[model samples]
Target: MTPTITDAPDRAEAAALLHAVADPARLAVIRRLADSPACVCDLQEQVPIALSLLSYHLKVLRAADLVTSRRRGRWLDYSLTPDALERLHAALPAPPPRHPGPTAGAGEAATPQPYTAACPPQCADQIQ
Candidate 1:
């Protein structure tokens, strides 16, 4: 989806989200959630990080809305928020288009003769 400037979380909020995922360990946690939701114990198995560290990372993620947790018996299950992820992607500048220049060439037999069309009114080089 196109990302309007207002489409993202506020700058401060966005910064918070970026900071939450800044840690390498926490980033891995997000990646894991990308595949499937997991409880603390299940994440521990996948992350191989210390319990305290994992908890801290999860706290960061929760605060940023990147993840949501629910009580499941004694465990808290966490899942990714796809909208948050999309907002993150939208906030970042898009990569430039793959092909940027004129495609036609002199040696290309299928190339049409150069012809100028009426430029949009706002175009600086618009024909009179």
Candidate 2:
């Protein structure tokens, strides 16, 4: 969906947000977090990366505001931000709105002209 003007982030922040999920590991982390909150240990079980590496990915997710964390005793549990979907909605690089093609069978206007760039018939035979 095209975001409303108020829903869009400024350019630089948007770039950073897009970059956050650009990594495979981090994307996996976010995908899991989307379902529910998870601690680093919980994430490590699912992510193939080492603990240190997973932590690094989590840091990137946090920076993008794609995820949030809470400290419970020794564990840091990560969850998708309350507005994560909204930010995603805002961050989507909207496809340029398509112009309507001529309605199906609307008229001759819907037909494409034949290719005129082909070599002239005489030239075609010369190469043959």
The clash count of every prediction, one per candidate, is 0, 0
lDDT of 1 by residue, 1-128 (tens): 56644544466565676787889888889989999999999999989989998998898888888899999998899999878677677555677544323774555444343334655646634533
**C-alpha TM-score for every candidate:** 0.70, 0.67
For residue 64, model 2's alpha carbon misses the true position, in angstroms, by 1.9
lDDT (tens digit, per residue) of candidate 2 on 70-123: 999999989998877777667666655434356745333343434346879877
Report the alpha-carbon TM-score of model 2 versus the true structure: 0.67
Tell me the RMSD of model 1 versus the true structure: 8.9
Task: Give candidate 1's error at residue 10 in angstroms.
Answer: 3.3
Output the number of the TM-score-best candidate: 1
Off by over 4 Å in 2: 1-9, 96-128
Which residues of candidate 1, in runs, are more than 4 Å off? 6-9, 104-128
